[model samples]
Target: MRWSHAALNCGDLDTTEKFYTTWFGARRVNEFDLGDLRIVFLRLGDAYLELFGQARPPAGETPGGDGHPVAGTVRHIAFQTDDLDGFLRRIEGQAEITLGPLDFSAHIHGWRSVWLRDPDGVIVEVSEGYRDRA
Candidate 1:
């Protein structure tokens, strides 16, 4: 079987929705209101992404919010780009540029790649030459 969907917790539902739509062409497919918070589900092609508010602790207990980096948990999500230069320029203002569109001659079969951090500090990769595999 194929992988179905994945999710990321977003602090701002609106901003998360807009980011996905603008950067990855994801369309909103569902929404849920939890009184204190909301969740938005977005889809792009066969992949799905869900954004939910951070969970709160029980009234009398402390929040179990971990103090580690989210990027360390799942590595990253990558996107294939036809125009790596233009894509980098477009996201320059929106996200934090972590790495370059440097040529990865060995690891990526001579493709160019760059890494960016999303609003929640999750790693996102933009790479060329992925289309060659298709």
Candidate 2:
């Protein structure tokens, strides 16, 4: 099966939505509001993004603390780009580059990647010359 969307919990839905739409070119496809909760779906190329937010904690579970990036999970959600240099220029002074613009040519010929941290603390990888294999 092909990969789909990555869902994230947003403390502020509007900010999260704007971050993706502005920086990564994701567009809103659908949205829902259930009183204390909100969900927005966005599409980027063939992939989708699902964002959910809650006004308060549920009955038993505690709130996620400190707004820090979680580690040892998922690693990252990657996007392939045709122009890694041009993409880097576009995000300059606007988004935070957490890592890379480094070479991965050791693994794949002509491959390079850069990682950015989204507003919701998700690591997004933008790469060139990488593709799914059969």
Q: Choose the strongest candidate by lDDT.
A: 2
TM-score of every candidate: 0.76, 0.80
TM-score, model 2 to reference: 0.80
Give lDDT tens digits, candidate 2, residues 14-50.
Answer: 9989988887789999999888789999999889999
TM value for model 1: 0.76
- Model 2 regions lying over 4 Å from their true place: 55-72, 132-134
Worst 10 residues of 2 by lDDT: 58-67
Give the backbone clash total of model 2. 0
Using TM-score, give the best candidate's number. 2
Candidate 1 C-alpha lDDT tens digits along 38-110: 8878888888888887643224422112212435466677778788888877877887777676787665575
Error of 2 at 23 (Å): 2.0
